[model samples]
Target: MAESIRTGRRKPAGPLAYAALVAASLFAVGPLLWALSTSFKSPDAVLTDTSWIPSAPTLENYTIVLFESQVPRYLFNSVVVAGATVLATLVLATLGAYATARFRFRGRGASLFFILMTSMIPGIAILVPLYFLAVEVGVYDSYLGLIVVYTAWQVPTVLWMLRGFFQTIPTSLEEAGRIDGASDLRVMVQLVLPLAKPGLAAAAVIAFVYVWNDYLIAATMVSSDDKRLVSVGLYNYLSQYGIEWGQLTAAVLVTIVPMVVLFVLMEKRLVAGLSAGATKG
Candidate 1:
């Protein structure tokens, strides 16, 4: 009788919960779908009506954005600058993190905390000084300038993150390497690094994404249109006459796809890295 009654009854979440889930899903995907629809839409349709999908989808926007506009150059610049920034951040942050983690030096906590405090400062606050320094160093208006700027800004967070990750690594591993007559560098390279792979992957992904999407430093540091990164390049789509909604949407979506693909491919590694330290700690 109990089993028969249970079979007749319905499952939980009758109305409100299901509605909320459906609404949340739509909310998250709506904008992306809209952008994709807009990218293929006619300029007239974009302004005239609000439709989820384009009535007459076209590839003209992509063609014009890729061939006629400076979008390709901006894409190239973003890749170069972001790539360089990530590489620099990884090397500097990893070394600093290792030192902070393994060695008990004077004012270590104070230094780490102070370094982290800079994250709270708005980029606008230091823009003027950074611009002046860029000119002084003769790297202004150059890819190197933007890369260096991003590296400096992003490294502190990476250092803090990696320091925590490095700390979570078991000391016994290093001690074992020492027992086997391995040098400190060898231990770090062979054992410690191998164990900390997940953390490094997470840090790299974070650094790459931050630098790729950075706009403030890119705009201030790179003056030449040819050297502009994607974020600033999008501003060019706006004009006094009107905004090129279709072209701009196409450009934005194309710009986002690569990073999205990159993240999706490495998401597993990134999650593992983020959890590795936390789980151990």
Candidate 2:
């Protein structure tokens, strides 16, 4: 009886589990640490030790990348595109998610399935057609084009995430709001959305990160130097003769800093979003 009770009560924190966690964490963070170290190190240090710690840490690479290259402008462009994508995606995704979760409309499942199907389409396969559409519409090589593409591409997943969240919101809350003389739109604005704030935040952060890190669309859609987003603009640091590893690493880190900070801020919201469905159920 004692042995059975002990076995029943025991938790599963074994050496192998800890080792696996450590290995996964290292695998995920290794590139980031290497990049940060390389960014601070002079080219000579990279060639010599290649250690995480730089013998002579410096900000020269950051200064050059920020000031000398058109990186600052590209950063601005990326921020604009990402911001637009987030806002547009939130607006569309929230409405769609709410409708899908709450309404008993015709073809709703079909619409949702169609949305998810788009994700399976290889982006490169449709590039030529999308490029033509952009050119024909006179939005080629523009921030507007990138924003539209990112918003359209990401809205489906955002909708799925938010639909789950909205579904988890008690129907009674909206009913109570209605009993208190609230319309559907008002109920959504005042009650349902406020309740799903964490999920919305999670969706926004995901959209922001997606748009910010997208290189393929940014490279293809916006060809002008002035409109080039950060991901594409970073390619300027690479040359055939040799790569400016120091500057490139610095630029990469700089590009990632904003998203990292945002993710840290939204970590709680992300966790809440994950648990929302279970709690409601």
Candidate 3:
């Protein structure tokens, strides 16, 4: 009877389910495939050939973007800014989250709420003020300005995420550390942080991606081409004469490579980190 009930409850795979999955996959990857096709086509072919498969493919676009343009510089700038932002956000968020998770204090709930609320405020709303502030503070048109803004914007969300992850950690571990005469700071550094590696890895990837992809702050904060990020640097392909679609698409594909590589390498940790807090709160 139990075997019959289990068989009856199992849903059979349907053609419609398979069809929907294929359609969704195409919809998501369609643009990327088109861009890849465009990047391989020559200048004239890009406009004349509307077919998904290019009639004639060339390496000219890749050659120009890699060696002839400022894309490499822009890429370096993005890496620096994103890396620094991740480090700063993790440090600040980890400390703040640890305090919130371990210590019982007055206004803790209110403080966490306020921090999360800051993230809810649309970044666009403060663009002008941030621009003026960066200028007034002497950090305008510099990597420092971009890193500082990105760190400030990312910290609140990361703090809340980490706080949840910290809660999921057992208090008995910390108690054991205390029994060994370890200081709170040492306990956190040695015991808590090592266990929270997955959460930290997840947070770092998120913060890194945010800074790397942001266009507005990179554009508004830094006017110099030398300090421009990859997102804003892509605009260089558009000139008064016309747009270089082939080169632009090639650059786009190249820019996506780093993120793809990162996701591939950190997929496991990211999944674990994201799910770790789900059961706690």
Which number leads on lDDT?
3
RMSD in angstroms between candidate 1 and the native structure over all alpha carbons: 5.9
Record all residue pairs in model 2 with backbone atoms less than 3 Å apart, i.e. clashing: none
Q: What is the TM-score of each candidate against the true structure?
A: 0.89, 0.88, 0.92
Report the C-alpha lDDT of model 2 over 1-281, residue by residue, as the tens digit: 74577567789789999999999999999999999999998777768866789989989989988888887898899899899999999999999989999999899989999999998888899888899999999999888988899999999888888888888788998899899999999999999888888888878877888888788888889877899998888886565216878988998898889878988888877776666642442
Ranking, TM-score, top scorer first: 3, 1, 2
- What pairs collide in candidate 3? none
Per-residue C-alpha lDDT of model 1 across residues 98-208, encoded as one tens digit per residue? 888998999998988898898898999999999999899899999888888898898898888888899887799899889999998888888888887788889888988
lDDT of each: 0.85, 0.86, 0.91
1-281: candidate 3 lDDT, tens digit per residue: 74577468789769999999999999998999999999999999999999999988899999999999888899999999999999999999999999999999999999998998999989899999999999999999999999999999999989988998999999999999999999999999999999999899999999998998898888889999899899998886566227889989999998889888998899877877888763466
Best-matching candidate per TM-score: 3
Off by over 4 Å in 1: 1-21, 278-281
lDDT comparison, 2 vs 3, better candidate: 3
Question: Which 10 residues in a row give candidate 1 its minimum summed lDDT?
Answer: 272-281
Superior candidate under lDDT, 1 versus 3: 3
Model 2: lDDT equals 0.86
lDDT of predicted model 3: 0.91
